[model samples]
Target: MFFKEVVASLYAWDLLDENVDHALDVLQRETRTNSTYLVALMHDEKRPLTDFYYPHNPRRKVYWTEDSRAYWRPSPDGYERIKPRLSDSDELAGTDWMQVLIDASRARGMSVGAELSHTWIDKERTRTELADCVQRDVYGNPFDGQVCFNNPDVRAYAKALYVDLAANYDIDYVMTCVRGFNPGRGEGADTELGRLVGTTHGGCFCDSCQARAEAHGVDWAALTERLRWLADGYDRFNHKQNFELRLLLASTANITSLLVELPELYAFLKFRADSLTEFFAEVRTAVKDVSPRTDLRLNHYAGHPELMGLDLRSVAKQLDSIRSSDYAEQSGDPARMEWKRGYLHNIRRTVGLDMYFLSAVSPRPKATPELVEQGVRISAECGADALTIGHYDGSWLDCLRAVKSGLDKVGIEIRPDLPMWQRAAPALDGNPPHEIVPSSRS
Candidate 1:
């Protein structure tokens, strides 16, 4: 009985097919979910063609939105203070995608939500206008993706972006999708040994970050020196003979040793976490100040939140809900079953907020139907308030059916919101009645 909602995260391109009403109907019937969160901002560059499951028409080119642009237009009051450095989507500009989704969702009596990726900014525009906002290494070299959370302009822009969404739309919720720092990207080495040896790119030592470090009592100079030494050592190790063998020999002892040798890493990590929690608190207040009814959520994909500087327990207090793919046992390892089982329960009990574990329904190396059902059972068992499937478009019918079956097994019944007449169109010859394919425009 802990489950209060079932939300499907749908891509914008999924609705491009002409049969907007029919698409929503199909989504409801298949996923048996009462709500949806439309991805309106940007897309993943690494998404392959196979990731798209929207059965396309013959004439339509199989393409996805590659730009880091907001799909909807900002209002007059929005972005008046700071520039988010955002660009308009060439393919979907003037389409009013968010409003279109809200209207369609209203017809089906379904709630609508939106998510904004923290790092998905227009790099070209940002490079010109707000270059200091971008994350930087100890050497002050800027990372391509993430903007520094410590930067004042970036923080202001984040608040403005969420406020804009809440003020402009009839949305139910707004989630911040953050991919914090990639602590495992050891400059160019990228290995577990690199992380253990503390050679990873734990950065944002830009002027803002350095100032924040000084204010927070973190010795920025000492931390930077340690990071440089580690980077040099890693480089030297790579050039040495039998480097792979040396890497494999490294262990967690190296982590402990590194922590002992360089204790400033602790303060730096805490500062990173505190910075994010502060950002979330500010954005939460900003959104609530503008539109009190709109709920805020955090969707962070990385595991080991401590390492990534995301203190989930503290951050959870600022969110109405949280969606995490980590600790889901998505890897399907039976040995880690208890870890997955306790994840949601612990968070809910401790933080006293809704927790939504993202259950991916994609192909292999992602998730299968059995795993999806098990994930549902686990979420229900853990007292999670919601379950959000990664996407309706990327998912198959079998996985969606498994969700319903799992829910039924747990005494949860999901009835379609659409009326009988408007429930679903007749299925194709070989497909089931609930199965829906897109209509032609030309």
Candidate 2:
């Protein structure tokens, strides 16, 4: 299989291929790389994602994770899931858009996976933290590593949500859940923490986190003391006003090296490592019980671990390993000046960027020839199987072709481990227009 050979896969290509046929058309047009796999998503109240017409459409089945909160809303069409709510349907809504995509993508020969939306907590079940992994809610209220492992209610809930979809709807993989996103910047806070007008977003101070840590063999009180130590005299640093420009200068390596090597810190802040492992195992086992041949992958951002109380590398090693999302704006696009700098070289996912793509960064000049090459080559050398050049609502220009050409030469040839390779060390383009936020790891 194409996926078994390639170390990675890029989920989207050119933003074309609405469904199966469109994808097949691309495969027919190209020489077709054997090392890549396509990840197909389902769309509801929209076009069928099938008609996948490529040689390397999607090797796996399907599942869908969409933005749940309006703050995360990509655009007008983002809120289709659980929308219009449910009526007389015996099993929730009739095969959600996720099911549609999974069914169609499989028909087109793609691997489907779901990172279910945020709002859909098992209707009859209570949202409780399991004695497990660390995933926090919008309020920074930590969630016990998901309940799929030890809690039968959770396991059964997940099974019901997905199993029916797989058989009745024809999907292949379900990503279980999107790691709970802790909206530290106060997307919905009535208090000072919510305002985040200019304060540190010391994330997740919840009771469940304390309990989950205990279940996972953590010394909770000791960990709390360590956190206090880490935050000593730091309440003065306002997340807004007191933010320092120099923190941006701190190298990602300086910040990343810490979390990659230390699992204890993950346990201390996040609850427990074993619980996460068992949680992922449960997801896989549960999916397998229904679709024995399907692949399961848990979602986690490449560089967000340490900053967000997550251990991404550990999660990567724990799950099946597929790179998720990377959003950035390039100098070629006019909007490039709008976004601050966000790079992904330091991530170990650089080693397994299976099924991924680039999104946002539009307005032409923003998708600069320089930025495109840098981003794509970074993806390839880091072992990305395929790459997606993204644009919102069809705003892409020729930057993709320009970057692709350069990639044929110096792009994938560099080694990620070497310092020289990371930058080739370019100087600032003089008086950059935007003041991008520096690494959160600092």
Candidate 3:
């Protein structure tokens, strides 16, 4: 079965002979995979793929620091400082790895796309030692890093960097790697393990943001606090509880505020949304600038209300296409798969990112054909365009089987493209790289 376009989340930063050979073995063994793309979602200081991949490399680790050089986003100063650097120490086997993958796919009679990492702004970096990278809601609640896109500096820097990356790596498809701004889990966020609570991902309330809020005739801090309140409340409460408080967070909470304090929130959010709109526009243009033939794809990362501020439909009316992911993890329980539809539905409406459910990180090398059948049918209920079996670089028998079984059920072919990269194995505690750094709680 040939997929429209299959891809792999290549975590090959530490690819060794054994790993590469292992991936090659899988590449040799699996069948029906067509035109597998590479997921360059990497952001170690030594691994700045964006210099040759995406514009404005915000080297954002999952809830980590912004991944870019002298990058900028929204802050009271009107810009977040993100210095960019180049990682050109080592060379992979291919002359132009991205293009090589494209050529390889074409040789296999398949079209290819690259979900290259556009990750530049890491959400979780200690802005100041002992200072949390993110902030709490205005009223002091759940903390989530707000990806501030309004800063012209970040846009300028990202555009400049993207131009270089796209110019260098010409693949068939180009999509920015949307990442999590919040991490360490929220109080009531859904997790494979249990309840999650932390103040992560919310961003600065600087003078510039205040100015923007005032310009919009609003109290910037108040509005920001309101948004954080929503995130915190959601973190503190389960999905249902968050739903109950949404009205309060969005509007009712503002009812009692002094009119002077009211406009800032609206102003700040409006500025944020408009700024992102501008960035995306620039991203589309930059990609076109680099490789006119390349198609563009963007992500809505869960429900980004800020991005939705100006109506994502209107904001991104000009881009080629946008994509979203369910990013599902493998599970023993069928209900986990079934239960995910709710998450996707809300993301679709909230961000209006026109997303199609993409289930990845499945317990591959372990999934049964029956399990694949059930998951495939259930995931498709959300109007998924296609299914790609996520194959990590460890004990991947189940992932290979998942590809075959799910494709068989969906009447698609297995795309046997080479592993563009390798990723770490799923952690039992959902915490790989304990050496990366400890959470504030730790």
- Candidate whose lDDT is highest: 1
* Least well predicted 10-residue stretch by lDDT in candidate 1: 433-442
Candidate 3: tens digits of C-alpha lDDT, residues 1-442: 2323444543333232234334433544552444355544334343222122221113332222224322111122222354333333343322344444555556656555655353554434424421232333344333332333444555554555445445655455556653322332333434311111122223335444455445544545455555454445555455654664554444443333522343433343345454445556666666675577665555444443332333355343434544444434445455666556666555445434343223333434334445655655555555444454444333235545565566567675433352212211121232111122111110
**Rank by TM-score (best first):** 1, 3, 2
Per-candidate TM-score against the hidden true structure = 0.80, 0.50, 0.59
For model 1, what is the C-alpha lDDT against the true structure?
0.62
Which residue ranges in model 1 land beyond 4 Å of their true spot?
44-61, 80-91, 184-196, 237-257, 326-366, 414-442
lDDT (CA) per prediction = 0.62, 0.36, 0.43
Candidate 3 whole-model C-alpha lDDT, 0 to 1: 0.43
**The candidate that achieves the highest TM-score relative to the unseen native structure:** 1
Steric overlap count per candidate: 0, 46, 63
lDDT by residue (tens digit), candidate 1, 1-442: 5455667766566666535676667666765777787776774453323444344332254555555667666665666445543334455656877888888888778888888865656777557666777888766778766778878887777888899899989998888676675463543445544554443365667898788667655667777776555554445454542363355436444556655555665556667777777777777778877887787877756545565667777776667666655434335565555666655555556555333333323322345677777777777776555666765554556766777777777776543342211111111232111111111111
lDDT: worst 10-residue window of model 3:
433-442
Stretches of candidate 2 off by over 4 Å are: 1-96, 99-169, 180-207, 221-267, 270-274, 329-365, 368-370, 389-442
lDDT, model 2:
0.36
